[model samples]
Structures are given as C-alpha cells and as structure tokens.
Target: MAQVLFLGGLGRSGTTLVERLLGEIPGVCALGEVVHLWQRDLRDDERCGCGERFSACEFWRQVGKTAFDGWDNVDVERVQALRDAVERTRHIPRLASAAKPAVDVLEYASYYARIYQAAAEVSGAKLVVDSSKHSALAHVLRAAGDIDLRVVHVVRDARGVAYSWTKRVARPESDGTDEMTRYSPGRSALLWNAHNAAFGLLARRGVPVRRIRYEEFLADPRAGLIRLADFAGITLQPTDLDFLRPGHADLGVGHSAAGNPMRFTVGRLPLRRDDAWVRSLPAAQRRLVGAVCGPMLRAYGYPLNPQETR
Candidate 1:
C-alpha cells in the first residue's frame, strides 16, 4: 500500500514550510499541491518547484508518463471541471459519507491515486507528502480507500492568516506580471472557520487526523516535526532537524505544482513568526476577524479578545 501524508489546512498556515522540511527526509517526496496540477500548473504553464515550466520539467514529464501514459490521456480541462464540482466546502459531507460516491468522484479519486502512486514510484520514496491543504480532497481520498492516507490539519491564528491574505505579495513565477491572491478579513475569517470545522467533521467521522497549530510548531519546530512524523508513521533523526541554521532552513529542490511561491525557494528559509498583523493590521479589521472566527479560534487555542493580541 502507498503511504501518503496529506497536509490539509488553510493557505498560508505554513503547510509549504512543513512539507519542505519533511521532504528533506530520506524516503519522502513532497509533491507540492497536486490539487492545482490540472488548472494552474498544466493549464497556466506555471513554474514547478524545480524552476522549470510544468511542461518542461523533466520530473513532471516522467510523472505524466507514469500516471497517464505521457499526459495525452490526461484531460486537464475535464479533470479541472470535475475537481471544482466535487471538491467544495458544501460537498464535504457527501464526499466523506459511507454511501457510494458519484462516478465523477470515483474517476477523480482514481486520477488522484494514480498521481500519488506515480509520485512515489518516480521519487523512490516510501512516503509521499501532499501539501494540497484541502480538507475536501483529504476526505475524498480517505473515502476512496485506495491509498493509506494520514492527515496533518494545520491551523494558524485568524489574525495572522487574515493579515497574510491582505498583502499583495507577487508570485515568484510571475516575472513581475501576476498578482498574488488577497482576501478580505471577513471572507478569510469565514472560510477559515468553515474549513477548520469541515476538517473537524471528518475527524469525527473517523478520519486519521493529527492537528497542529502553526504557532505551536513555530515555538519548537523540532518537537513539532517529531509529533507530525509520529502521526504519519515516520521516524526523524536529529540530523534532519539540522536543516535549520540561524534564521532559516537549508532547503533543497521540490517539485510542488501549486502552493505559496515559497515552494520555489531553495536554501535558507527564515524561521520566524509573522505577528506583524497584531500590531500592523487595522484594529477594525482585526476585531472583525476575531468576531467572525471567535468561537472557532477559541476552540483552536487562539485569543479572540482585542486586548490579548498576542
């Protein structure tokens, strides 16, 4: 059976960083966010983590040939449409249900399995780390039962997440042309709560999940990685943690299809908390985010009171 470590959570919650660090381990391959493979990488010809356009990347070319016979049988448009239809917040319950899924769901699951299988084979790794950060996808994979799936549900403070999304950071592959994603505080808060709740629902439904708060992980990444590795049924050596040097991690190449542009970063990844939101974000927006995500934030051990911005 193929072992998969599925990283499911909201964007900008350090999923990419965790994936990168873990991928540094032997016998593990971090296949960025394969969720965006069809639409973003293949369709838009985005740069892979290896700095090659998806089509030009030798690794993905092999993955394509391995998964779907040279990418000819892979209908990017059809799969993209299928993904959008089946992988939505409202469809979480259905995706996780014991009832038989629709044919489209099965087809998509099969495609995803093939991708994971090929990734494992091509990388010669025992475990494939998929940092898709989509809970619905995790539910779909768990329901399919084709691969051994484990979940790492990463969470970050709502204020930090809200602040990250508000910035207009440019994509590294954009060549100064593309605009990064930015969401309103209200929208971010609503989605963050809903997304975290959906993952919790999956856990209640018996998905093998381990939750990790980004702040907690940042507090002590070595311990955080050990806990994550334990949950994923992997072992980590102290030397693996040695990837950290003064301010950042010494990273290597990764071929993640879609994620924060940090996927493209190689070597010296700074390890630091981004608490500027607490002091820099507008008080009204911070309060708005707190109000919107208050209950869920509290459930996840985040302070909702304005006075406790820490």
Candidate 2:
C-alpha cells in the first residue's frame, strides 16, 4: 500500500493549494479529489492538470489499465453509487468502529487502494496526496484499513470560507461550462462545524492527524511546507526548497484529475494571504457565521471579532 497524505477540509478552504504544494515534492503525486474520480474524471472526461482530456491523458489511462486491467473494465456508474452509500457524513460514526464492513464498503475501498497503488507505480511516487475535502470519505478510507493514511486537516476562518463559497468562480477544467457551487453563510458555517468536528472525532478515534490553519500556512509557506513534508515522511533537500524563492512559488504542471482552477495555473504565482473576507464580508453575515461556528472557531483559535486578523 502506498503512503497517503489525505487533505480533508471543507471546499474553498485551500486544500487545492496544499495538495499542489505537496505534489511539488519529488516523490509525491497529487491526485485531486479522488472522491470525484468516478463522476468528474471517468464519466465526464474532464481535463487533467496537464491540459489533456481524461481519455487522452496517458497518465490516467495508464492508471486505469494498470489498476483494473483496462479502463473499459471499470463500471463508472456502479462505483459512483457505491461511493454514495459508503461515503457520507452519516456513515462516519458507524464506519469508525465497524471491525468488518459490508460488501459494498469493502469493494469501494478496494477500488481506492488499487487507484492509489497504481498511481504510485505509474508516477514512481512514494506517497500520493488526495485532497478529497470531505470527512466522510476520509472516514471510509480510514475504516477500510488498507492504505497507510495520514490526515492533514486544513482549516480556514469560517467567514472567509463562506465568502469564498459565495463567489461564482468558473471551473476551467470543465471548459468553462460549469461553475463552483455557492453556499450561503449559514450553510457554510454549518458545514464548517460538521466537517471540522468530524475530523476532530477521527483524530480522537486514533487516526494520525495534523491540523493546519490556512492563515498560518500563508504566514510562512516555507516553514509550513517543511512541516508538512516531514509529517508526510519525506526528508527535504535544499534544492527541493528552490521552488520557494522570495515571495513567490514557481509551480509546474501536474496531472491532477480535478481541482480548483488554480490546478491549471503554472509558473510563478505571488504568495499572499487572501483576507478579503475580513473587510469584505458583511457584518451581519460575519456575526451569523460566528454564532453558528463559535465553539469550533474558538477551538481552532480563530478570533471572534478578528481585529487584526489575516
């Protein structure tokens, strides 16, 4: 089994960036949102991170062939349905303790194992990063118990996440035909509570977990990347840190299956914290988010009023 660094968090909370950073490491391959692999990558034939459609991308085509004997042998619809049944928030509690799983759960987990193993073999990576951004799926993988998994629970301030979800950003991988889904502040806050709490529970149940706040990561990316790399069992060489020069990152292309539009962005990108929600989010909405997410917000060390927050 390949060592897996599973980035679990709410959507729009910078999992894509962290996953990309991890993928930049020499022996790490980033597979964007494996939870969406069946529907988004396999069925929809969306673009890969390297600018080729799924069917045409030699990397994923090889992954299919190696994992399932052939891509054509995979039943996309059946796998998608299995995902729905076994990977849901409601199933996490039971899954965490299920010594033996139902037949469907085992089957779903086997597919994931094969995919991760195939990805590692094809890319020649020691570890693979999966930024699936859901507690439920993390629970499923943890419960399945085959992969060597570690969770990096990325968290951002609820207000910023809510503000991000409100934006109508285009999904460039979808050929601009679709947009990222929007969520109201209330719904986003509820999700922030649910997702974070779920991961917290996962940790309490003995899963090795590291919590990274997005603000802290942006505060000093080099330090953050070093910390994460160490956690992922990779020792860094000086040249590995060369990509981080001054205040920017020199990013190269990858073959990620699905992620934010940033996945397609290569070359040097400026490094800065996006704190627009601090000044941009409406006061009432901020208050609403604070009220809904008060417990975890405090638990995660976010300021309630955010006087000088990033």
Candidate 3:
C-alpha cells in the first residue's frame, strides 16, 4: 500500500505552496491533485509542472505504463462518469457512513490506488504527497481499500479564501486562454466552511489526520516544513532545511497533475504572507463571508471582525 499524505482543503487555501515545500524533502514525491489527473492530465493533455505536456512528461508516462500498462488502456469517460457518480462532495455523507461502497465506487477507487502505488514505485519515494484538496476525495481513497491514507487539512481564513476566489488568475497548464475558476464571496465562504468541516469529520472517523493553519505555516515556513515532515514520518536535520534560512527557497522541479499556477513556479521563491484579500476584499463581501463561515471561522481561530487591512 502507498503511504499517501493527502492535502485536503478548499481550493485557494495555499495548498500548492505547502505541497511545494514538502516536495523539497528527500523521500517525498508530490503528485499535484491526482484527483484531477483524469480530466486535466490524461484528457486535456495539459502542461505538467515540469513544463512538459502530459503526454511528453517522462514521469507520468511511466506512472501510466506502470499502473495501467498504458494510458491508452484507460477509459477516461468511464472513470469520469464514476467520479461524477460517487466521488462528489454531495456523496461524502453517505460514503463516510458506510464501510462498504457500491461496486462502482470501489472500481473508481481502484484506479486511484493503482496510480498512487505506481507513483510510489516509479519515483521510488517513501511517501507520496497528493495535493488533491477535495476533502471528499479522501473518502473515495478510503474506499480504495488498499492505501495507507493520511490527511493534512489545510485551513485558511474564509475571508481571505473568498477574496482569492474573485481574482482572475490564468491556468498556465491550459492552452494559455482559460483562467482558473472564480467564485463569488458567498459561494467561496460556503465552500470553505463545508470543506473544513468535512475534514474535521474525517479526523473523528479515525483516519490519521493533522490540521495545519495556512497563516501560521506561512509565518515560518521552514519550521512548517519540519512539522509537516514529522507528521508524515520523516525526520529532517537542520542542514537538510538550510535552504530556507534566507526566508525563501529555490524550489525543486515538480510535476503536479493539476493545482494552483504556483505549482509551475521554481527558483528563489520568497517566503512571505499573502494578505491581499485582507486589504482588498470589499467590506460588504467580508461581512457576507463572515456570516456564512462564522462557525468554522471562529473554530479555526480567525477573528470575526475583518479588521482594516494593514
């Protein structure tokens, strides 16, 4: 079984940056958003974080061949249909309640198992980090019945998340035209609350999970990496992490199947906080986001009042 450190959370909560930091560790291989690999990598033939189109990327080409004999053998539509059927956020409740899932759900999970195991084998990694971000997918991975699954729930301020959703960021992995999806403040708030709550339930259900708040992680990312590495069962000496001493890291090359455009970034990346949302989110939307995410916001230790941005 593959030991997977699954990064689960609402989108736009800094999961990509965290994943990149973790990938720098020696024994961990980061597979960005394997949940989206079906549509984004295999179907659309998008660019990998390595800057190669999916078909041309030697890493994933090997992962496919190792898992399924070949990507050609994959039934993309069938997997996609199965995903829509049982892998949705709406299905989380029913999926979590049952020990056994329907035949189709099991079959959908089988693909995930193979790919993750194959990724482990192909990369010869001690741990595979999948930054899929959908808390619901963790349940599906659970159903796969053969993975050593662990979850790291990444939480960010709902207001910041809502504000990020309004930005018009381009998806570089695409044909250079399509942009990342943007959501209204209300919708983003609702999603933030729902996903965070779902991950909390995952912990109660006995899947080994550790929670990491994005703000605290960013405040001291070098320490953040050590804590994350410890949770994942890897130890790092101070020398192993010396690269981050300058308050930045020249990130190593990565081949995420899909994630924030930040996945494509490498070189001397500054470690700094992104509080743009704190300043730019309109007061009205801040209030609206606050109302929708009130319970979880306080639960996660965020101030109710979005104080004037510094």
Candidate 4:
C-alpha cells in the first residue's frame, strides 16, 4: 500500500514548507499541487511553480510518462475519454477505478504514485507528499482507500490569509479565482472560519491529523519539523535544518526551493505572512474581516481589539 500525505489548508498556510520538509524524508516525493485532472490542460496558463511549463517540465514529463504511462499511450483523446468518463459519472473519483480498461481510482492514485515513485528513484524518497489543499479531494481519497494518508492541518490567522490574497492579486499570472469573493474579508469570513472550524472538529474527533500554526513554524522551525516528523512517522536529518534557513542555499536544483506550493525557509526577519493585515488593511476591509472572523481570530489566539470587533 502506498502512503500518501496531504498538506492541506487555506492557500497560504505554509503548506509548501511542510511539503518540502516531507520531500527531504527518504522515499517521499512531494508533488506540489499536481491536480492533473482538475485543470483543462497540462499546458494551460497556470504555472506549476516547478520552474517549467507544466506540460514541458522534465520532471513532470517523466512523471507523466512513467507514473502516468498507462494513460500516456492513451493519446489526448483517450485522456479526454477518461476525463469525460469522470464528468458523466456522479462520483468523480469513485468510478475512476471502473473506467474502461479497468482504470480504477487506485490506478489514478498509482499514476501520481508513479510520479512520486520516479522522484523517489531519483531523489531516494519513500513517500509522496501532495499539497493539493482541497478538502473535497481529501474526502474522495479517503473513499478510494488507495493509500494510507495523513492530513497536516496547517492554519494561519484569517487576516494573514486575506493579506496573502492581496499579494496574489498584484501578481500578473495569478489564478484570479475570486478567493476574495469566496471569502471576502467580513462577509466571506465564513470560508476561512468554516475551513478552520472543520479542522478543529476533525482534530477533536481524532481524525489522525497534526495541527501546525504558521506563526509557530516560522518562529521555531526545528520544533515544528520534529512534531511533524513524529506525526508522519519519519525521522529528520541534521541537514534538514539547513534547508529551513534564510537564504535557501540548501535546496538543490530540480527542487522548488522556497517557491510557491513546494518551498520553505526560516526568514531572517521571520514575520508571519498575516502581520501585514494589521497595517495594510483599510478601515472598511478591517471591518469586513471583523464582522465574519472576529470570533475566529480570538479562537486562533489573536487578541480582540474592540474597534475591530463586530
């Protein structure tokens, strides 16, 4: 049985760091956001953050070849056929295993497994870390019963999430998926609130998860990594600490190395990504977040400032 580790949480919650650290573990391949089926095309506009056009990235190309080989010979049309089979069926991944030629969800899982397997062959990893960050997909994998999975429930303050959203909007190649609209500061705080709340409830029920705070990770990465390794049942190397350092000189080529989705480091200044929300947010924005997320902030250990309260 393959072991799958999911680094799931809101978009900017240090999932990349977790994925990178896990990748360092022998036999673990961290495929950062390789949600191949979700996107329309591999060559579509979105960058995989692997320093390559996703379709053309050599590593992913090999991943597509060896890992996704079964589908590789299927041609574009066959890939489409597989995709259409998914769309028509009510259960996206449920009937995946039953797809024509008997492609089950495990095969789908295996395709990614191949990617990790190949990466492991090259990088000497034993597990594959997937940072898709989708709760719905997590449920689907749980249903498939294909791999032993552990979910790292990473979280940061809502304001921090909002701040990260602001930075993304400023970038040229951003996904522009209306995350702000989905969870607009005040009114949409439900998106973040419910997301965090779900993790809390799951943890309380003993859902085999480990909670990691973005603040704490940045403050003392060594402690965070130690706890994370314990949860994943892996040991860390002394060199692992070097990878978490400021300049990111430790990460080798062919790795994301402190980039989006699959990178991490302890910054020299070491500030929380959400810190700017306090200084950068306008009164209206602050009011918006306060209305929906005031209680959530307090729950997450933030002090309540009366002016920002509902």
RMSD of each: 1.5, 1.1, 1.4, 6.0
Candidate 4: segments with Cα more than 4 A from true spot: 24-27, 36-48, 70-123, 168-183, 200-206, 246-249, 254-274, 306-310
Provide the clash count, candidate 4: 12
lDDT of 4 by residue, 1-310 (tens): 4566777777766777667655655546677765443352353434444554555556655655665463345344544454444322245234324334234444444444445455555545656677866553453344344466777888876666765665633221245443222344653465677566655544443347777777777666667777877777777677655655552324443343123633423223232333666777676776677667878787766655633422
Cα lDDT of candidate 4 equals: 0.56
Candidate 3: regions farther than 4 A off: 308-310
Better of 3 and 4 by lDDT: 3
lDDT, each prediction: 0.85, 0.88, 0.88, 0.56
Best by TM-score: 2
Error of 2 at 305 (Å): 0.8
TM-score of each: 0.96, 0.97, 0.97, 0.71
Model 1 misplacement above 4 A: 306-309
Deviation of model 3 at 183, angstroms: 0.4
TM-score-wise, the better of 2 and 3 is: 2
- In angstroms, give how far residue 134 of model 4 lies from its true place: 0.9
Task: State each candidate's clash count.
Answer: 3, 0, 0, 12
Q: Which ten residues in a row have the lowest lDDT in candidate 2?
A: 137-146
Q: Distance from true position, residue 30, model 3, in Å?
A: 0.3
